[model samples]
Target: MSGVGGDDEHIWRLAVQKDGKIVAAGHVATAAGGEDFAVARYLPDGRLDRSFNSSGSLPGTVVTDIEGGRDQLRDITLGTRGRIVAAGSATLPAVRGGTSFTVARYLRDGSLDPSFGSGEPRPGVVVTPMAANDDLDLAESVVIDRHDRILAGGSADADGRFDLALARYRPDGSLDRRFGDAGKVLANVGPGSTDEDLAGLALQPDGRILAGGSTAATEFAVDGDFLLARFRDDGTLDRGFGRGGFVITRTAPGEADDEIFDIALQMPNRLVAAGECDQPATGRDVCLARYLVSP
Candidate 1:
């Protein structure tokens, strides 16, 4: 609500700078068309950093693909040398029907990094993985790997059902095909009959990847359990953890729908995740789960 916009706006994610400054990222609604990635920086005392983007905030877009459709920033992270990396989804304006996972990087001065994702062909160099088949793709969280690579986590529509999607890119914004299948991995947590999403991601000290979200068992049903998965550095599922590298916790099982909105490491090989749970009898409640990180 701090933002001045008559239309609906949102601050999806934020990150802290090493200098104690704050960088906030989200989307801003435009009068001419769709939303654009809106980013701003603030000093420790809460004063807007006038030096950022040469203003309180970048007046125009910092990153986008679709000129007439929506773009939303789901998460941001502090990268090497204090650079800023952002992840979200951009609607495909040229394609009449879908969205794509979008990412962008900015220098310390808040200027777009030229070496980052600049698209020319289908996922040629952009943070997005090229879509061989049409599907709505979205990036909900992002983290920097030990090698300074970029890893994105979210959901993708596969045959109309949402599946956990993760993409890894080099520091220069090029997809790392050596990772997942062609630089991306779509994990089916449900039976391909329900929805699933990766809401958060954490890169382990050993280069393993941990992702957490939610998934439902019933087809098309919203009620589900908190889902967690681990991946090796090479993007293959880790069979040692959970059941075939997956964990599902049902707080209310068939009685309510649960979800994980964020996750963090608790140190010493422990992880904690938190979100909201809804039920017919008891409105909404804060949900939390912690696990020993063996991956």
Candidate 2:
């Protein structure tokens, strides 16, 4: 669909409401050459749901400028009471590795939820810097737990290297101190890996968490492997699962690159991951892998 001024738009995630309305979150280019977080709602018939953001300039869409900089929502999850939680990264031009993990909650009508992040730097928005030095931090996947807590997963820079990172937030947009250290957890799937990024997140029936992404083998490696990590409710690694709570898989033969961009849990005891793998003859090929969840 057309975005703000029909500028370049990139949708990163979509969710269907209980009533069959489709909600999409992404980023739209701005006149200043920056990007803004954009959300739109559509009816089941593929028509814009003008019922959303009715009073706003755009009938069915809401565009937010988190910091007057580059703000994009890479993932969105529908929470209880029709609340929408979106997560991604916010970047400022002046700071080194300026990106920070950003999350915003919106009401069903596409307006910012004033109850969240009300007293923070910005109302209805939460920006988390994973590193003290302003290193790059991004939240690519988001999920709401049974308790209504929000969980965002992506990558955090760790001394120049990237590690799979997860952050949990309370309903009020405050970091849940009960989760991981200070509400944040970082996992390095492969030792010596230069980059480890989480692109998908899932919650198990038992309250555990699953994260899937990719890990590059070396500093300048062109090849990567699918990486998976499981964690307990409190955010510690689930040692009983894959080797030390992490799994690395090479989807293709030889020194090909493989990365998992999304993951889903099967009913009983299986997990499926989908992404892309470098194929020797066909360049890049879609790849899917199923794993048996350890009892």
Candidate 3:
């Protein structure tokens, strides 16, 4: 509804609680010219929920500075016991314009859960550096599993190229080594030089993970294709799915960009993806695609 900080605020994701309360999260511009993760809870009627963050300067709002730099929440999900988990990217000021996958967990009262992340970076915040060379990595989507484990999907720099990246964290916020290579997995949907990013993530009924986004042929390609990748519970590619666990679809015939910003699982054997596809004649148009879950 209204601005939370009076300054510039951008809401990129929203989640509704089982009790009908709505949670909005994004980034708020700080007076210092930096940004901080901002979250606010509102009742179904659009009124601020005073019950949240009541002790803060702004009722029903919580602002977190993960690394004292730029922080934003691109996706929000409800966790076990009504906890809120948000995922996005945080700038690492020490890395010279580098960013990393950032996640923060909050209790029902909008208080940071100190029991979550290791205090190396910040309390109640988990900062994951996808590359050792300090590259830009971001988590655009987040989902919590039945076991309360957290899964974040986005893009990670792979040797100066962007690839679809996924990371799983245990309930305690520690990297789940049982997942990919130390709780992280990166998939190259196109050529090694292509940039692939995952903006949507969904868990199938059987716990399989599905991520969808876009892949650009070049670093500055004006046109791109929709990209989807499936992974087993253990984080390995689902070979039984699309070609080698990846599917690339060009929504339009020629030079047009088709990006999937979100995905949903539709029962027995289908998944639906929605985003925008650029049309040469007419600006960008809404696009939707359905895929069979099987090979």
- Per candidate, the number of residue pairs that clash is 0, 0, 0
Model 2, range 1-295, lDDT digits (tens) per residue? 4856336899998999999999988998888878899999999999999988999987999999977778878999999889899999999655544799999999988889999988887789988887657788888999998899999999888888888899999999999999999899988866565678788999998889999988886631367888889999999999988899988898778767888989999865789999999988898899999988756
Cα lDDT tens digits, model 3, 1-295, are 3566537899998889999999999889888888888999999999899999998888989989877777878999998778999999998866643799988999999998989985545678988887657888988999998788999999888887788889999988999999999999988865457888788999987889999888888752367788888999999999877788888889876867788889998865799999888887777899999999853
Name the regions of candidate 3 deviating beyond 4 angstroms.
95-97, 118-121
Candidate 1 local lDDT, 74-130, one digit each (tens) = 899998876888888887755433688888788787777777765544221253633
Q: How close is candidate 1 to the true structure, as a TM-score?
A: 0.90
Segments in model 2 whose C-alpha atoms lie over 4 Å from true places: 93-97, 219-221
Model 3 is weakest, by summed lDDT over 10 consecutive residues, at: 218-227
Give the Å error, residue 152, model 1. Answer: 0.6
At residue 238, candidate 2 shows an lDDT of 96
> Root-mean-square deviation of each candidate, in angstroms?
3.0, 1.8, 1.8
Flag regions of model 1 displaced more than 4 Å. 1-6, 55-66, 94-97, 118-132, 219-221
For all predicted structures, in order, the TM-scores are 0.90, 0.95, 0.95
lDDT of 2: 0.87
